[model samples]
Target: MPVTPSDIVKFIESRPGRPLSAREIAEGLRISPSQRKKFYRLLESLATEGLVAHLKGDRYSLPRKQNLVTGTISVHRDGYGFVSPREGQGPDVFVPARFLREVMHGDEVVVRVERGGRPGKPEGRLVRVEKRAHTTLVGLYEQGRKFGSVHPADPRLNQPIFVPAGQELGARGGEVVLVAIDAYPNEFRNAEGHIVQVLGDPSDPAVEILSIIHKHGLSHEFPDDVLAEADFLPEEVQPGDLEQREDLRDLPFVTIDGETAKDFDDAVCLRREEGGTSHLWVAIADVGHYVKEGSLLDQEAYLRGTSVYFPGQVIPMLPERLSNGICSLNPQVDRLTLVAEIVFDAKARRQSSRFYPAVIRSRARLTYTEVHEMVEKQLAETIERYVDLYPMLTEMLALSEGLTAMRRQRGSLDFDLPEAEIILGVRGEPENIIKAERTKAHRLIEEFMLAANEAVAFFLGQRDIPLLYRVHEPPDLAKLQAFQQFIAFFNYGLNLEAEGVDPRALQELLAQVEGKPEERTINQVLLRSMKQAFYAPDNVGHFGLAAEHYCHFTSPIRRYPDLQVHRVLRQAWRAGGLAEQERNRLADRLPEMGEHTSRTERRAMEAEREIVELKKCQFMAERVGEAFAGYITGVQPFGLFVELKEFFVEGLVHLTSLSDDFYTYEEDRHRLVGQYRRRIFQVGNEVEVLVQNVSVERREIDFTLVDLAAQQTTAQESPKGRRAQGKSKKR
Candidate 1:
């Protein structure tokens, strides 16, 4: 029952001293979820009318209020910053440069709302800085006459940290150094720091990557205690290890992975059942068996969250001894595993599923290319090498197709976008940038893993267990509507309605636009509109996979959440329905754990992206004068960004380079049109460009527009003009 305005007022006033958040107010009013949007609007209206006080951090109280709002301040490189509210459904208040006297990015701050504005552009003034996100900054140290300055590795952290005389800590100019902040700047002076550690000169090829690693705060080397703990992990499965585990070493389980893959976390085997059904044995490496809870290894793994992968480097969550040796499901070696044994019906729906500890010796370690050759191309050498497993491989192909069809039919949105694959030399220099290839071999393993993950999540969720779920929330309504309007320009029918988004609708749109000229553009737009999937204690389901139940059940060697899930499941297996004590403890802590893992996961991603981007920038730096044909991917008032056809790099072509005519930006149309010549440059337009510059510091490549069309037109016109001039000269 929705409470009346009078009832809401009385409840709010009842808590006289303390403030009530929007969630609490809604709960008190018995407001259901469906009316949440409207309820928020009502609260906003009340606040605007001065009937209710919306105070600091969006908490509501009596009519008397303070203008201060508390949140995290994200300072833009241009000096301005935005403070996102800490407590309610409100806009991020923008703080001007003058008010941000000593603020840096990621500071917990209190802001005074000067006035109300649009949700996207609210105005505010900084009142106080509650907490500083970082005490140390990593960057290049430059020695000045009076003092040294630190150029931060992160470009967004634009302001240089000043180092006073004799505080350089023997760090020379152009060297990457870690600086510890001693003082934060005010309107009177610049922020000051002292050099703590010299990481080497930025001119060194390796130092660039080193700077990126430190900037993201990722730990690469394991601690001595953690490494010592890993030594206790068995090199091979012993009799004691398999005491309570089912012995399945005789089964022909095989590991399928890339040629360069060192750690094998999962292995699989299939058996055909009666009535056109199949049984899948997905044996995952038993990391929890070796990495006991509260141990040094477990602590380190949790801190890392997930392994970070670069072009030719991998920072493993666990030590190499565990990730690649004992815990890896190596062929011909007995490995302990937690298996999700599943039986699927003819329609590829899981009929029954069970999980238990097991020991398995993988028959062979197979590469994707080899599998593709054996299964798809029917290569003689491949068949002869694995002649005994040939029959099982063929059956696995059929099963994989069925599972793929089942997922697709359920409205799973699979984006087949091309991802960059950097080929590095022995010395780690990028030799070439190519799109990562996906074969049937990749899908075969993917389908099996997806099934096992879904099975485990469904089982745990049904039991009312508190566990981490890989959740993807639905897209924001405003972004979806904006996307719909943009796609309409291509005559594509993408009518996002008030009923909210569904995976099915997005899936249908992608299928319809496949192989079209606008395929990549539409795919990029739709992907941007979707929310990022992350770990959560509560299950809202995975939207992209169209899965009501989904979690990371495999790859414990690299991901912490998978290891956590394994630990929880193993305990439940022994104790049976976790006691109220354990359950309550998990319920209290899982949310925080989920948030930490998610942040670490994002940290790893940013580090990887930064490294790859730096390599791409370096590659483009050598070809500054070359010309290339590419397509316009983005358009803005200042310039258009074009993605190269062969190189796969995107660079900006500024509007000032349009020599034929002055171009004016059309914001709503997403295009730049010439004022006099009427020439147009729009997203998806093909054009030739000359590489203008590449800035390693900014991690940007620049291109200048090449007027091939105008050049050809001029060439044809010149001959006619020359012919008339010749006639006049002959007369």
Candidate 2:
């Protein structure tokens, strides 16, 4: 007999508030004995159709509330978890520790929501494990006489997995190993696994970097086939290919970049036209000419979103033959390129533009220092001092500054944050850290690339073409409001109305903090308050660039998103038709691509951070009890993070080290105030600290107070208090 919707409803209604077992429900409904065994199957279908709810203990019931969603598990080290839906529009759900089952982080699980008012917070439990996100984890091997276990190094992986004796990891007590999860954790037990690769001892510095690469799941090398394919490519450019592209063989252009840069992707040429207009030509490497779509090279490039650059090494997405030799716009060499020719009006507005494939001949390659000196000193010294093409270089700088001013007038958010460069000595050992200052040479190249990228995006959109744009949506209103409250202490407040906030406001705020001590601290906070950029087929526009249409059409040698954009642009140009069906297909696929590429980019960034942190640890390994001046970078209930001015190394000054009095953290005012002495540890305050200890094993640096007298004298310089929008009253 066929079961009707009313029949399923009636069966579920019978359970009411009780946890009815599948068998019990069948018996209560007086289902036939032959069909009794098939009763649970019907209940499963009913659960899928939202007709009934599946609770713990193999029980069934009617759903009692709204916003009750089932999603996968993503656990955190802090014992809390977030549940992102298997399908639909609900803000990511949160589950507290008490309700979590044996499910590990990144596990696909069904969750039952608990009561909550805020849409951001969702409490739930693990009803079932649908799938496992990663079956492998990097960890350390440990033994307990007869039994053995793999202690995971990834903090998010909370529980350890068991290993059998026969599959002995060949790892000593402290050795790192990669463990493969054979079976997942259930209600009352940990997962089962066996060690796959037994990485050497943890004390070795090389092992530390290797572990970082593995922990983040980043590839360190290309495949054999990929290398073979690269090796077979032509060593030099042929004359035949040049015939097809526009001959810019006589045009004098220059390649400007860092002294260490090998893969030159762009070359610029600038000229002043009649009517005081500027003629700008930006020639970029046309990688699509050789690396066709759906090829092995393309697949590999897509997987690796961007090149991974470490201290002394780089894992490039494209082969060296192409990235460093053939496609590179080296001086005195002919290279195939995609050129953007634009005529800028006297006002620096892009009046007319065209894109075409071309072969470019570069006359000279100039380093940033060489060009900067030429512009700064007006080429006073000998021209034979490796300073070439001073006139052309000066013209390029003028055009770049003009374009920049035009962008600023159009509401571009120009956030200039400090970037640190690690100074490495012999055999890859850290010597010091220096801040990387941006010169006019750097800005000149940047502004030109931005102009070209914007033009490509507009050209594609005009054709109604499908493209993966780098989009940055507006900030979360609630988070922005929270940031607003904190800024009010400075007699300042952000425009909370969604439509009122503009890039100009942020630029104005940044301009105000130019040389102030609070510049770094406040800039860091403002950066965190903005939304992140990601790859997507839909054009939400980039908030940071202030561009209505913006995509990465440059840097195909490094970024995978740019390569994809390159392929789309080429197809649109050749076919002169919009791929509507392909757009629909990619639209379905792009969201997932966006999520993955974003996650990988984050992973790579984290890997870079870990490498730098380890180097910092290594630098301070032997400096215990040394005193140096530093600025307070962070403040908390437990301690303060102070960054030294001399070395740029940051270490913690725990609350216990402050022997004067008990201190409490004030979150809103961004300070730590002593209960008895009234001493304050505020952000941007300078103080002297002694390096107390350095733990290479833990990758942590610790510090203690050095000049208590100076601290007391400087304590009187604290800023006066305002109405304090986000501050709390003293307890």
Candidate 3:
């Protein structure tokens, strides 16, 4: 057998506490001279993975034997950091500011774990830096007398990059620029870098969004070769493409999406069968048909991973020629697609499912608002406008209701947190901010997509095919215990002594807290208590969805994992089943694919969220000194985070601005209490506040109490507090 990582690991483990050199390891394993280079590379790979450690004198040993732990360091804005070990389930090792003087955030490092530290947590000091996270960073350029420096846009970096006089790239102060690092920071000096790209003025909205795009390392533009490949694709589906495709042009397939949506990836059609059965056809755009594996387009799509959507703009995964042109299932167009034909019984229980390539002509393109009016509001004008699609729309509604009931019965947790919707003007400035509404029509489409995804996942899983599964493992026990303690303050409870907490119990808890004052707070806390869902080759099942098998089979145009699923399904269907060699190839490739796509997905989310927060700050900047009724959504040592009642915006009220009395943070109660007056400000409490300050560059908003004097007087007079004992502490 070839020299595998496992073989090397076994050899190392055989001689406990004895480190071996590369030559010694190769000689002991009988590795031929031809395999020497491969062996060295594999050994280095093992070191990077934290499987082994490189000691002084070029010897290798298991990390644990040398009291070393390897992991990435994530630094807080406050100068403290934590190292999450690459191969353990233990708590992260906390590193103080003094020990992190030589390393930047997101660097891979080996640390020497010590016994004493914070209670119940490990502490560590950096042994060495193994890898750097960034060679290029986006920042605001600043000019000094001798040389220029760039202030990193990401707060976690927290260090200024020095630029020599000649390397400014003609960038003036206040301009946003991308810097390439020439020398990393050490205990003695700051990092040094040269400006490569001068992005425009920071005050401009376009430049502001671009800054975030570059900060997150997102690709905003496609390469020439990828674009050339996309442009070569047929603008319309060719006749030869229909050779084994089932033609569903006669069916009344209509796509329902948002009014502003341009790329429609899925269309739905429902047909009633005898004996109270229903046939559902979900056709997803056939992106895999044009972007062959290992092609330029496919490589680009794999790199981009998923489309990043900001307000009024999108950084799409594929070029527009494919994403918006041929691959999109546009209305009244002959589009190629991969269809999931599912048969369901009267109770919405899936009876059977089949997958195949198909051609579909969407009868009409309808918005969620239009569908809502026709089905829920029963509006005559809207129903009359698309009368041909109205019947199918109603049938879809009925089927979706059945599916929703089935999913709920099986214990899926549904969160009702309102998302902020930013309405922008023609110039891309925020016109208004409001809560996004989720009408029945939205849930109708959501239910159909969920059903289709589950069906496809079950089909692929049964045949033991290798694909990326949307896996959500069970929550960590410690987190759940802490959550149980938190909910106890509101008199809500969950049983934890059981082997595993069922999703149904959590669902029931949500139902109990519905419409209560602490509903959103508890919901948000429980969500935080759960582990994040990620794409993986192994099937752990999705906990939030209460699914036994689930994967992303819809939205291939925007998501690379969905496109991967489509390719695997099509290949298996054509070949009657994947051959052993093909299966092995896919099995080897899928783990890395899962890791890359998951990472890109997180990067996209962070970019999208940062832009939205920036826009919110800008919107609030125009309303300084304005008072708004809000609720205290979070309480911390430094401040209270309050969300506005009228607008979906959150701002911080620093404790220093309270002004009336000295306040103390009560962690267990999740509240801030006044020491002298006995006044309490807790999560879910209503408060009125004025917009004190807004920093667009920092993406921060500050708030102050509107009437602190009156509130203090009321607190002193209330039966819950003792009479005023002394003068209040003044800021």
Candidate 4:
């Protein structure tokens, strides 16, 4: 039976001192959800009549000045926390450390929100911990008298744990270990816990990186079910399956990727047509062939959302048997693929496209370096390795060049940011970190893949099919305005005209500042101004690529969205495709899938960055008190962030260490300045600094300012004198 206004009033009156939110009350009474607005109106009517007392924070309790709300406790590193009420009803109630009921970060808790001294701002005391965010945590294990304690790696957790010596789980001092929170102690001093597993010593090369994975709750190993499912996959393709796909065996297609890349998911072939036209075919691995929906492999892939790529290792979403074997487009192997066959005019305007399943035989496997060298210099030895692919490679280069021109004409923003490559030694220690330069070969493959992605998105959109699209929305007007203001320091102003702007303007700005010292900082700011690209069922279009439509149609083995796209395309092409029943079923599912994939991708990115940061800390562990030239990337109340010119590693110059001045934070200006001396530290300023200290536990690099007099003396001297001053001093 539907709830009535009278019933709501009666229910509220029956329970004394029972505080409930309007939405919560509606949910409990089984009212028509859309009628929640009217339900709230009824509650307001009752409140106006003085039957119930409305709390200052819009919470309706009984006549008393008490209310109960359920919210998640977000603990700060300083120990104080805020309980964020559900549905944004109440202002975040600040909970002091003493008032906290042993709740940690991300724990959902029931809180009593009542007036303290302030009228608008209310105080909350946690009544109960409704849900613990996590059961396992990564931390350091310390031995004590007859017992051991675990200090959590992620400092956001407000509580520490104590484990008996018998349940220490063999964790050694200074070693990172996984601990299970068995019980929440009555006192906040110590939490009851037991060690589940000891990760490894922090000094170990990859231990910090692995611990970051555990800390972020990402899986490092494939589940047993997924592995078992992978083991059953066929090593070789059967002739019957090959018969169903288009025979592209005769085409000279090639796979181009990093030299270290083992799983080749995309292969391409291109040719010039009459009247300056071009024909291109992108063959992507048909992963959905083996990993059926509801299968263990599929379930695991969906959960992972994407492959996790570390410096020297990759935790693949699918097991190696599939990712590195059958689905991989290895040279000379006949593999099943969903190919996007496109026809374009010489100017690189897409004429038409058709999606089909094909049996492709890659004639050669080419590395990015070899392909790049062959394209630019006609490296004979490299060309001979794939003689048949030379013509196709030439065609791909030409078509890709033309396609990129078209995209640029359409306002595509191309920022050539240098990527870091870590070289690991035999024992997994990082030998060196170098920037990986991009070349034409890489661009050619990238452009080809982008075209295919756009084509797939367009094709799917034409059918009005719901699928995961790589959507990049236009930048927020306010953020763009702020970015324009920031660039004025470099005398570079953004022309966000009355007609508004697009990605091309940003690209032009990047080009204008290419070789300048401010390029990196400006590029970062421009990127920040733009909205993030995410997976979505709605096709709002890609702002960065300047495409009306875009989707991840390649790299299915690594990305779950690509795999999902492949599945949708396959279902559409086979059996007269995407039946009404199937479409209806996916209508509600696609949005949720997009949201999950976007969230998981963000978490994976955070985990990846944290590992890299730890490695960087490890690399510079022995280089304290060393000096290097660096550009200021960020400035805050605490310190100035300096990005090293050579290594691209960022470190902080704490305000306390800048002894020449009393620094104050200017939020609007994005800088810190000294009040008395007026010394300025702003983004994009180049300065020399010493690596004063490296904090392994905090993953921080602290730097002190270089003496101005010494810097001027070094500059006044010749190159030889500067070289002498550059001599290394041991820590």
Per-candidate local distance difference test: 0.86, 0.77, 0.91, 0.82
1-731: candidate 2 lDDT, tens digit per residue: 65555776687676566667877777777788887657668788766645566766888776543234555667887777988875453667778876665778877566677666376665666566655777777788888688678877766777788887867557777788888889887767778888888877776666777778887788777888877777777777777777557888788888888877888888989888888788889888888876777777777777877787777767787888888988789999888888888888887799988888898888887788777777765567734564557667777788889988888776677776766678887667788877776888888889999999999888888877877788888767776777777666555656757663777676667777767776677777777988888888889998878898998887988887777777777677677765678778766876777777777777788788778888888889868868889999877789999999988788999888786788888888878999988999987888899888997756789998786534643553444232232243542
TM-score of each: 0.88, 0.85, 0.94, 0.83
Q: Specify the highest-lDDT model's number.
A: 3
Off by over 4 Å in 2: 1-78, 82-101, 108-110, 115-122, 377-387, 498-500, 579-592, 695-698, 708-731
TM-score ranking from best candidate downward: 3, 1, 2, 4
* lDDT measured at residue 449 in model 1 versus the true structure, 0 to 100: 92
Q: Which ten residues in a row have the lowest lDDT in candidate 3?
A: 722-731
Best by TM-score: 3
Estimate, for each residue in 1-731, the C-alpha lDDT of model 4 and write its tens digit: 55665687667666555577776677767768787788788787766543454555566665434466666788887888888876545567888888764777888776777556477677877666656888888888889978888899887775678898799988887789999988875653667889988989877767777788888788779878789889998998888887668999998888999989999999998888779888899999999998898898999999999988888888888899999999999999899999999999978899999999999999888899998878877999988987777877887888888988888777898876776777778878767767777899999999989989999999988888879999998886767888988888678878886545867777778779998877877888788887879999988989899888899989899899999898888888776568888888888898999989998898899888777777777777778868888889887788889988888688988887776667799876778888998988887788998888897777788876678535555664978766766763321
Give the clash count for each candidate: 0, 0, 0, 0
Cα deviation at 238, candidate 4, in Å, is: 1.0
Q: Any idea what lDDT model 1 has?
A: 0.86
Clashing pairs in 4: none
Give the distance in Å from residue 52's predicted Cα in candidate 4 to where it truly belongs.
Answer: 17
State the local distance difference test value for candidate 4: 0.82
List where candidate 1 sits over 4 angstroms from the true fold. 1-64, 117-120, 708-731
Q: Which 10-residue span in candidate 4 carries the lowest summed lDDT?
A: 48-57
**458-575: candidate 3 lDDT, tens digit per residue:** 9999999999999999988888889988889888889886566888889989999998878888889999998888899999999999999999999899999999999999988999
Q: lDDT score, residue 286, model 2?
A: 83
